[model samples]
Target: MSSTKRLLASIHDVSPRFEAQVDQLAGVLENHLGKGRFAMLVVPDHWGAAPLREAKAFQSRLRNWSDSGIEMFVHGWFHRDTGQHSGAANFKARHMTAGEGEFLGLEEATALRLMREGKALIEDIIGREVAGFIAPAWLYGKGSLAALGQAGFALAEDHWKVWKPGNDEVLAKGPVITWASRSAMRTASSLAFASLARTVLPHALDTVRIAVHPGDVSKPSLLSSIDATLGRFARSHRPARYAELS
Candidate 1:
């Protein structure tokens, strides 16, 4: 491989919880060598019966990552069941079920309120302003573009490209992830394969995007695929630092 492309991998989680797996992911990247140069999408301590106390832990840990120059993108206001989405989902949607999304049922007002509060809370906990918003399932309903501008974030990413808020210029363009839609199937990389295909095909592209979820990693095949993806990236370009790009 001639090291023609680079990668940006982001991990998502609901805060004040899942700290273990989240940290384990950090460890995985650290142990994976140069992979530490990637990023982590920090989700908020979303509404629940009581506030999650993990924000404090998130704060301390975030500082270390920040100081080390790790990238941080806001995952969502609440990684909860919004019961709606901008568009519809087939019963087999991977990240969104009909039960989730901006069109599924999320009220525009409530979603914005959560976005405002979540942004405030994450910045308060981390002691730094978050840079972007990634809706749960990457399904920021048709109403979300305006909400994002109001949320005070600077970047937005999905299956398409990395974009600045309120702009059409895609900082990067490519598929973000790969997985089976139904249960019990092994892992795959639509992005990696596409990236590879582009390495030779007529519409050759020079960038690759990688998105990771804790669940996708626990599986052996997916984990290995992720490793291979990182391995390719190691020689391609200095793994990008999130904050630097945004």
Candidate 2:
């Protein structure tokens, strides 16, 4: 709202399955802002598989990334949706994501357990505390909000803003711009949205959150749009970290 124009580049879905793609997208960010200007949203276990603690080399890589000033975030427990949806949830699950909303309807106790376990696992692997947690698909159940406080995460992000977990302290307000490569139609729509955002976003708001998922790297045009979008924002705004938002 202030038109100050702060930029944040985040690499989402950092698991072994997407490591190559993560590296690919990361390289583009590294090229733009140099090492350490971006962030990583790492899933502790993606799709109820591939736990982070089992991958020593990946843990080491995350350590190196953290040490270099790239902020690390606990993405989700198991970035997979295992529940039925209805009404708005159904609409969201059907259109916004490919059913990856893992925390969308979890009970408070279950959500707390997952969040605590995930935070601990990531901390043990990285040997450093994480900066925050972001639920998969940026969707959280009402109970998950309370559970975040119980789990003691310093920060959490939804689609529209970043906030303190326990207290719900709003840190920054802005919609994150991201691309999806789950299908050709999604990729094309995302690019068109991004193209419009390129010309309109900076003038309308102060903060711009560019969240890049690994799958997006698989599409040439999506990747190109990401690069161009970043370039356009960098021309007017300086790179920033979410932790520094407040």
Candidate 3:
């Protein structure tokens, strides 16, 4: 590992609905960093439907992961999109995530409520405090930001930067290298982006994030890219937890 660069390997959407996929991807990531070298963004109740409390087996797995050094962060409350969007946000919701912006247009109160509940539930279940909160699709509304601050969440992330809530302190700045396989165009573009980033990013940035979603396991190309990207970065950077960045 290079002393000048750091990497964050994150597994997204850890839920009962995506259990098998999550395990598979985790295994893949482990091959790169060993166990406990990554983080898991947990959805308390994915799509406001699949609640973690109901999945006893999955809860146990999460607890073990937590104990073994996998950092946990509360993701969106429901991991769904229920509000309308406009401007750049609208375009992002429509294109970037297919409308999975859970915190994009939430009211301050609503956002706070969900954030508090989700964080509390995750902490209770895992018997450890969650390190941060990241909204679904990396979209955070002004209200959501306000809510995060009021809720006393110390860390939060948007697409290009990681920041501390209440203080507006930036911890890192860089576009995350991630993949999307929801459609043909998205898959093609994502692979192109991954390839380009792998070739270009190490020269320009000190910190890089590789966020892996469960759906990525379904695509062979994505898995290959993930492996190559991780391998490439590992040669020149050290694995880091998000908390260490701050």
Candidate 4:
């Protein structure tokens, strides 16, 4: 492999519920990086609704994308944080995300079950192995980490880094550049961070990851920011698949 720095892009919260939004983000990414160049983090069921198993058309679409070389990743089963927490988990559950860290408070058995089921479901739909597993909001607890290793996922990522679950080998090191659209404050902050990153990250790291959520489609400013950020990096960084890091 060449030693060139790379850019990794992905669309998050992919499900029937956000089909339109995912399409919009995908289109934007394709415009900059071409089709099948980015990954999609699919939620098997979004907030206990819009299960992928029941969406036949979406399943076909996933398979088509998979066949086209787009990577699929098991994002989370429900993509909702419903469990109680305490201490560090409690702090992360309350502050790191707004009730979206599905793996942050799970027990080992429950996490393992969800991981297996989610991986199986995505693989069946796509007719291929998923690229990896990533917890919603990039938050993980002890049990989630333990279960990730047992679940046999080759790759897993948090906010700061991507690593192999089995041997804990660090494949990439850098904070993921992502945007949030839930609130005005978050939107502004993320935009500012992305602007800074667009200028600084290329010179600072060999691998840069950018993730966009379906909610970002609701904000025209955020979408525009995403386009500009992606276009800027696409010039300096080669578009890369997550699997390449492995």
Which residues of candidate 3, in runs, are more than 4 Å off?
none
TM-score of 1: 0.78
Q: Cα lDDT for residue 235, model 2?
A: 78
- Candidate 2 similarity to native, TM-score: 0.95
CA lDDT, every model vs. true structure: 0.59, 0.85, 0.90, 0.92
Cα RMSD of all models vs. native, in order, equals 4.0, 1.9, 1.0, 1.3
- Worst lDDT 10-window in candidate 3: 91-100
Which runs of model 4 end up more than 4 angstroms from their true locations? 1-3
Quickly count the clashes in candidate 4.
0
Query: Where is model 2 more than 4 Å wrong at Cα?
Result: 1-4
- Candidate 2, residues 1-246, lDDT tens digits: the string is 233668888998899768888889889998887789999998988986777878888889988888899988888878998888788877887777888988887888998888888888888877788888899999988778879987877889989999997778898887889998887788888999999999998888678889998888778898899999989888777787877875
- Candidate 1 structure quality by residue, lDDT tens digits, 1-246: 344445566777645566666776666666554544767776665434224345565677776775675666676655656452233543323344323343224556766677777777667665677767777666655456666666667788766777877664567776665443235533344435634643443234456566666665556665666666566555554455545554
Question: Model 3, 1-246: lDDT tens per residue?
Answer: 577688888999999989999999999888887889999999999986789989999999999999999999999878999898899878878877877899998999999999999899999999988989999999988899889888877689888999999799999999989999899889999999999998998888899999999989888999999999998887777888888877
Q: What order do candidates take by TM-score, descending?
A: 4, 3, 2, 1
Best by lDDT, which number? 4
